[model samples]
Target chain A: MDRIPILRMGDFLLVTIQVDMHDQLAMTLQDDLTSQIEKTGAKGVLIDISALEMVDSFIGRMIANISGMSRILDASTVVVGMQPAVAITLVELGLSLAGVQTALNVDRGMQRLRADVAGKEADDGRHQE
Target chain B: MAVTKSEVIPIRTEHDIVVARQAVRRLSVEAAFGLVDQTKMVTAASELARNTFIYGGGGTLQCESLLEGARRGLRLTFTDQGPGIADLSLAMKDGWTSGSGMGLGLSGAKRLVNEFEIESVHGQGTRVTITRWK
Candidate 1:
């Protein structure tokens, strides 16, 4: 089974989706990402979809699921680098991606992920978690 | 309503869905579809292709490059011989799913294309056709 790699970087995990993922591939990614966050206790996840030319409902729902799942596991997920055309088609497809955080580029996504994780950690530390 | 080029791809598995999208994109580009048009066509193809596979069991995607007057367009037809949809209106409603999906496949694909049409027999099969003009 071909799998998308999940890279670990300090307190964060980075994934760059570079292919037009099939339904199975996308499902595998959803499972792999949640488990990786749980095992590594990662504080954040950054997904770069710049290489993907299309993101239909299947893929879009996977992104939203990843974010929601990561939140329950005490992590933040930021998706970045969506092409303008892909974004336009996504809305027209009726998938507004509500509740999913996004950024224009990977750099910004990383920054947002870092800040979100840092803020959460500070609040937790003060509460003795 | 003249097809300048055409091809057929069998949609038997998830990977076939990816192939369908790529095929639609190639034909759309050859027909001089703009970037956004190509994206819309390809995305719509993805949605319909998956429906043809998952809900329809297995099927085929027919890609056509059309020349109607001065407009060049791409048309895709998905056909399957699975247990067809019983209630199409309810199925087309947003956020309604048979089991495991966002339930946006039919309605969403309709919105992304210039033309959409669907026909199904309760116990026979389903066919969805869509076109995007460039």
Candidate 2:
């Protein structure tokens, strides 16, 4: 069984999609990512899709599902490194990947995630006070 | 215009969809399609291949590289011998899926290409054809 590895960096989970994902593989990734988020209690997830040449409706939905699931598990997801062509295709496919934050690269994605976590922490502190 | 070169690939499972997408990408590039055009064609092929596998119970893809006058293009036809769609108009409507998908395959694929055609007969089979010109 081929699996996409999920790496952890500090409070964030990193997944770099390098292969052309099949349906089963994409489902597995969704499952693995959600479970990993639970086990690590990560604050954010960064998925680097720069290597993916195409993302159809199915994959687009999977990305949205991952982001939604992460949100429910007390984490944020940022999809980064989308190619211009992929973006165009996704829009044409009628999938905007709404509700999922995006960035140009991994570094910027990480920064956004950190800021998100910090904002949440601030809100939590204010509530406790 | 006649198809210059054509290849047929079977779509039985998920792996076949990936292969079909790669084939579309290769043919589009060979036909001198731009990056956005290649991506759109590959994405459209992938969507149709999934539809063939999931809804049509497997099918075959006919990929053709076209040269008409000074214009070049890539065309693909997906045919399946499964239960055909009952309502094509509904199927082509966005957010109307017969399965668990987001219901964007047919309509979205149509938006990606320059030419789109679909023919289906209930209890018989279905065929979808698309072409993107460069």
Candidate 3:
């Protein structure tokens, strides 16, 4: 599909990459997420990729890019549901995906997102005080 | 070293890369590849497909099911008639991309497969063959 659906819940934006995304589609998602985070003023982003069967170098780079973009936009990004085989292959492929945060599933991902945002807010509060 | 089944998919666009990966996934399953092996094969196919499209300037991905006695394997061959790679050794090095890529396409693909072979002529074309046994 040309577009991946981005859902909003409170201050968090959720995205599930369910299909075998082509390179263009992956780039589109990265751009779309950046805009969504800005437009919604989202504090956190949870990207569910449990359905993703493979995280090739391109996909791996996209995920890392999304994570970086979200951070620079003042939003925390968490990638969830990576298949075991995909993870293994990614390592073998030599993509460490450094600077990308990951969680086991949607539940854990959401939890981590919430915690990270909350932690950021706490630091902000301290700064303001 | 016999191909039990084979199919060639064109790698002329981004969508074609997805098609090649899907074809490899299905063929890998038919060969009874484990989930990890199937994923690895498909991932390798993706890297090669991109090379065929981006660096090689469009090509074809050949998916084959191989049978060797009691073992079954999946093989993917990517070919393109583009300007070909001028430096095979440097091109194969990690973190050295000709374009704006992350520079791990060829090297990473090699790590994900059991067998990796490459052939290229500076002015002619390039061919990359990779295989994984189940």
Chain A TM-scores, one per candidate? Answer: 0.96, 0.99, 0.97
Quote the positional error of residue A128 for candidate 2 in Å: 0.8
Report clash pairs, candidate 1: none
Candidate 3 lDDT tens digits, A10-117:
999999888889888999999999999999999999999998999998889999999999999999999998888888999999998889999999999989988998
What digit string (tens of lDDT, one per residue) describes model 3 on residues B45-68? 999899899988999988888999
Per-residue alpha-carbon lDDT of model 1 for A8-84, expressed as tens digits?
99999999998879888899999999999999999999999999999999999999999999999989999999999
Residue B7 in model 2: shift from native, Å?
A: 0.6
Against the native chain B, each candidate's TM-score is: 0.98, 0.98, 0.98
| Residue A122's lDDT in candidate 3 | 94
User: Ranking under lDDT, best-scoring first?
Assistant: 2, 1, 3
| Model 1: CA > 4 A from native | none
Query: Interface RMSD in Å per candidate, to 1 decimal?
Result: 0.6, 0.6, 0.6
CA displacement after TM-score superposition, residue B133 of candidate 2 (Å): 0.8
For model 2, name the residue pairs that clash: none
| Top-scoring candidate (lDDT) | 2
TM-score for chain B in model 3: 0.98
Sort order, TM-score high to low: 2, 3, 1
Docking class for model 1 is high
**C-alpha TM-scores of all predictions:** 0.97, 0.99, 0.97
